[model samples]
Target: MTKTRALRLSGVALLIVGASMVVGPPASADIPFNVAVERDLGLSPRQAEARFAQQDHASAIESRLRDTLGAAFGGAHFDPSTGKLVVGVTDPAMTAVVRAAGAEATEARYSQRELDGIKSMLDETDAPAGVTGWYVDVYRNRVVVEVNRAAATRETSAYLDRLRALGPAVRVAEVTSSPRALYNVRGGDAWTTLAWRCSVGFSATGSGGSRHFVTAGHCTQGAGPAYGYNDEQMGSLGGSTFSLFGDYGKVDVTSAAWTLAGTVNRYGGGDIAVKGSTEAPIGASVCRSGSTTGWHCGTIKAKNRTVIYINGGAVGGLTQTDACAEPGDSGGSFITGTGQAQGMTSGGSGDCTDGGETYFQPVNEALTAYGLRIVTS
Candidate 1:
């Protein structure tokens, strides 16, 4: 594996840094709704609350629409502008049905199945190094393939042409920077593996009632005993996955000193209660907690995205978000406004300063893969 990026330790530069040293105080406490929602989303507290309610309602009915519409169900997203959920349907016959169910329906060129097929094809084929990632943009009703123009070579150009030949359903766009795994030290509440650090995703329970915590697979891959930021031994790295399958891992919490909590560190915002693992729909408001950046909020841009990190291999079934994260923030928690567990930080293109998109391994998939259930409040 490539050497992970190191933390710059700006404001906390004076703090002692080492495996046994306390890099910074652990973030714990409770606060109201995240203030970053106002900063990042440009919404007032009341407006943000309204959006959350609308998103929750949409999530509730999303399953019904999927089962009822079947092949006609293109996808669904919350429209902040109208404060309503919009459902995409390939069959015009389903439009009225969607409206009757209290959602606005729009015609889509393809169904979710077709889009998934295209993405699956891309997943099965080897992507060029210049290609950063790709996902189905439900709003656009097309599959978006992102490429790093600056890194493009003759081979990559030929590859793009071949992808175009796949049909109009494919939309290729240029990205300025490629994503890299945000691995190293520091995060929401820093947890160390050997000398390096990463944030904890969520606490979970194993089959035999064993305590565990989830994090980025890259963070736990080939790692030894796990420890907290204060160097308190927590557990042992159990199972990890970092290839095209996904980017998630489980750490068996073997120490009695560490008590598993179902809350995510919101830095100064306090600890956000994790009530459930309900997947948020695209366009719903979401926030991230990391030791590096604290709390930052953004909206879900897409789902089931596949991102290929510069050094780390392609990881599929990730959810794309506009939230920002920095080095040492890998495995941090991502939660919805309603306190729903989303995923853990995988990697991204930009930082909290200029702002950029981040991808996460959905917590539900990770829990299912490990035969674990999230420790909820």
Candidate 2:
């Protein structure tokens, strides 16, 4: 079996085991219906109950999109994995907006049979330089590209074309922009896993001119001496843990000086100013910027989720969304539709090409846990 498939299969296996243990039988008493949703989706009971409480208008939106952009787009599916609607479109421009909407849209190219064979081959070989990983998402009908940190926009576009050149059955649909700051950082730079790498921002602390940024606990190890973007004199891991893991540790401010900005760069030629770290409502829209997958938007799927991490144990009270992220994308930022700081990237199982669910540590919790303040303009 190919390595990608193997990884995915292994992840699924782990999920099953974890799920069996985490999701206990429902209580005999009148348990809330939302509790069942949380249990089934591998979410902590709290998250499921919260999502169940909110009114979901996603169905109406999906219906409207179908009527408004019929034929221009193909079939649509809501990825429970990402909590965003995956719209199939034939136009690249339309698909681009889908990305902006915080949903993922892909242009259909090859038939599933041909794409499957290509995916098998791609999965077997070590990914090319500037390519982090790839995934075959049957739900979205595309091969998702997880680009390397050093990958340039032109290079990413070239690689997409290369995939198309392989055969008439293969075609390039859409490409998500890379995060500018993350692209600026060198490869192997140490960073915390913020909301599974959804968005990242820099910070500073200590009376001795220590420079660092607060990220999600799910981003780095609780016991760590973290490194800088260039493998330089970054800060020590200081404190790290999955909040849900019942380990609340402050993100250490490294000695390395990082640029503190008043804006959240979306990396899609647009940006949202960092006003304050205010939490958005459950159904409110949100966006994220990260090193791996650039800026992507989606609605708040659920909040206060407790996720078990493979590396740093488990963290609770994460905000779930339909946004996409990759390995290096962890510890990034999640901002509300109005540009309020919501959370940090944690992690998930899919890629930006087809879409995936991402969890984030709420910013308020991060601030309260760390006694840090958000710098604003």
Candidate 3:
């Protein structure tokens, strides 16, 4: 078993997506939307609203680029500080098209297809104990490989050598904190069993047309007859998947008294409306809702991230954030200001008080994986 030691990362600082951002106290009352934005990101209400709009604008451009560039499209991330989108492309002809679309175009050394293939190759190899996680950093235009102290021992030298031989498109850095899914904590769409407690990611209906709510696969894996904190039988887990590629689960909501909504709990603040399941761009401001943290905001650091969680095993296709989350925040809500469904909490290294980096299972990936449609308003 991998040592479940807490992560102590000094490798890469949390990429500051939106400048002038800081954490603050949760809203005691139903603060104005702008006020809520101010609390989370420290932007004036106007700036907050404008930034949200910019994210939407950026997404549209990204969509267009994806359609036009296809394989040449490396990836896209939004710049919170300047309210612009940064797009990567392998071909120079695409650069002018991207700039014309109001994005800052950069020539990328490798295509998105190349990176995906490289990442897939590494995924095939068994990761040694020293390897913490590795993911494609579209912003940096390279894959980031994370290692822990265990790799320093002579025993793991050969494994490290093999990892380095994978390619020159990646950089390995020693770090701490093996991530584990935050579980057995109390709070948020709270569900409980004799063993564990976790949050509801979002509500959905699977291909079978059964009423269900999604959550972390780690929470539902190896478990059945799951019940809510309210003590009502919520039906056993179904279609639960974990470890590699993605971590998500579906719970068939069977209780008559309980009702599913497309809304998310906002702690003391009011509920957030789920407008759609559009994925937020990298560097775009995003906030999460969990029983532990209530609500907190941060910029999306990277997308299509692959994390080898100590608890859930290994999973790819995740979104990374600097937003703080503690135990029980797993499988919670991550939504944008415009109420776009982003993802659900996956294991991360830090707590809300001191601060930490967190990852989420992209909602769209989950929806597509299970052929589940997000319950949207």
Which one is best on TM-score? 1
Worst 10 residues of 1 by lDDT: 11-20
**Candidate 2 at residue 365, lDDT?**
68
Model 1 TM-score, all chains together: 0.91
| lDDT sort, best first | 1, 3, 2
lDDT of 2 by residue, 147-254 (tens): 534444566666766776776544333323222111112111234221111124534243454444666453444354444433333555556655443222344554
Tell me the lDDT of model 2 at 16: 27
* Candidate 1 residue lDDT tens string, 1-377: 11231232332323322112234543322323446777788889889888888888888778789899999999889888987789999999889989988889999989999999999999998888789999999999999999998887888989899999988999999999999888751225778665466788999998899889888888788857887766677888999999878899988889988888989877766677888988778989888887667788898999999998887879998989999887677888998878899999888988877989899999998999999989888
The stretch of ten residues in a row with the least summed lDDT in candidate 3 is 1-10
The candidate scoring highest on lDDT is: 1
lDDT of 1 at 184: 55
List pairs with backbone clashes in candidate 1. 185-197, 187-291, 188-290, 188-291
Compared with the true structure, all predictions reach lDDT values of 0.82, 0.49, 0.74
Of the pair 2 and 3, which is ahead by lDDT?
3
Q: Using Cα atoms with residue i matched to residue i, what is each candidate's TM-score against the true structure?
A: 0.91, 0.45, 0.86
lDDT over C-alpha atoms for residue 216 of model 3 = 79
Model 3 RMSD, rounded to 1 decimal: 8.1
lDDT of 3 at 113: 81
